[model samples]
Target: MQPGQQPQPSGSYYPQQAEQYAVPPMIVPSQMPMMMPGQQYGQPPNVPQHMLRHGYIAATFGTYGETAYCAFLKCGLGQIPLMFSIPGCTGAYTVAQSVLPHLPYGWRAADGAPVILLDCIIDQTRGPVVPQEVWMPNSPRVYDQHVVRAVLRPPTFFVHTDGSVGLPLPQILSGNFAVNNANAPVDVGRSSIHLHIKIHGYTDRKRQFQTQESGQWIQLRRLVGHVGRAVDKYLREAEPDPEQPVPRLRIGAGGIVPADVVVVGVVHVSSGSWMPILQLTRALA
Candidate 1:
């Protein structure tokens, strides 16, 4: 599937002859409002409607320059910092990846693309202060101050299961398990299921935040790392007995065996950290 596209069943975990399911409509860029820098949008009391949709304030850098542009998003848990830097005269810029957990699940655009808030601050004086490079040789910059909608791809999941059936890790983690029955008649009685999941392409860059202890910069790797470790520990604690053999099903009066026992074993895959990036662009006003 393409980046940011919804997952399709592979029949690896579903029962055969299962019917196809419909995914919810994706959020498109046109559905969101466009605003310029310093323009006032949102309800009274200083709350934006888009922020209400995701239950958190979204912020983006409205200005750019040759050296670097920095901004922050105020997630309820913590502040997510973003930095975009241009090293050389090639005009190429690298955006700092922002990481936050529990973002509204399945919040995509009307075109089935993922939707991320591009915070547009109209007040140039009040918005994020763009650091100026005085002695820099290359002065690359973008002067437009407007909001635009953009797209971003989603992450990939690698699932390891030791049981009578294989299941998609994303669906299971997202609590959408109905698709598991699309392949064959799933025998829910089998209790030997243990799942090990690894996610890829979540975060591309290391992020940092200020701490109370003398305002030191610290990497945000723990957010993703803690989750992986917690999941691993949970699966290990729930592991089934190693010596038990998988039970076989017998059919017909002659006791003929038509299907082999589906005993799956979990294979160890490399684990790593992930922090997803939100691709943004200037939407036409």
Candidate 2:
């Protein structure tokens, strides 16, 4: 079967994989989004999606260049929107969608810009559904922001199990392609994917405050950092060492076998913790 096509039973081999160089298909191959970066002739099988043993990833984001460009886009006047999310009680920690800045309303910041980590308490009684954004409880619960020094750079490319890029590792690149899969050479260096970020502070904790929620911010303010105070000045948080390397979030890292699933792992965030997650992009089950 061709790449992007419906997944088949395991131990399956396609002509291209078996042949060092495969002949063009009788018909053009379907351009499925599952196709990896260098994949021009064919795409990887969705079968591996199921075989993933590690936790899974749910979101897709652009490369570092995209991240930088997004940070500079101007709103109506001079404000740049800040983006971030909470990822609910349980879900893909969509690094790209969440972990953003530019909220307009809410607590002011300290000397530097605000880098708030609000672990908002959820009323599970409302069920297991929680929006990935900062879910503020309406009752009367205050949120605490734990600002950290660095954070994991979200992986834009397919990150393998060994923290390598390209060629899903566990896949036995059968036939001529075996070496390419085995060597797992880094066609693109890994440094671009591993990035760090600076956190800031915010002030004012009125129950109701305007948030920088609009992706299309028609009217923006001065895009400044290190210019505010901590949220709820009373809640004093221990200052973390900013000298440490920022942590990174690898959203989708898959491998071979049913146990080998796409996982969500954080590098350099306290004790490294990895969990099994589901891949929403490629159909596994």
- Whole-model lDDT per candidate: 0.21, 0.20
| Candidate 1 segments exceeding 4 Å error | 1-25, 34-49, 52-272, 278-285
Model 1 score (lDDT) = 0.21
lDDT of 1 at 259: 19
User: Given candidate 2, what's the lDDT at residue 26?
Assistant: 14
lDDT of 2 by residue, 147-231 (tens): 0212222222223334222221123121111111222222111221211111112121221122233432211111000001111
- CA RMSD of all predictions: 24.9, 23.7
Q: Name the regions of candidate 2 deviating beyond 4 angstroms.
A: 1-150, 156-169, 172-285
Residue-wise C-alpha lDDT for candidate 1, range 23-130, written one tens digit per residue: 112222344344433556562322232232221012211111100111112122112322211221111111123142322211233344333222222211121111
Tell me how candidate 2 scores on lDDT: 0.20
Please report the TM-score between candidate 1 and the true structure: 0.16
Please give the RMSD of candidate 1 to the true structure. Answer: 24.9
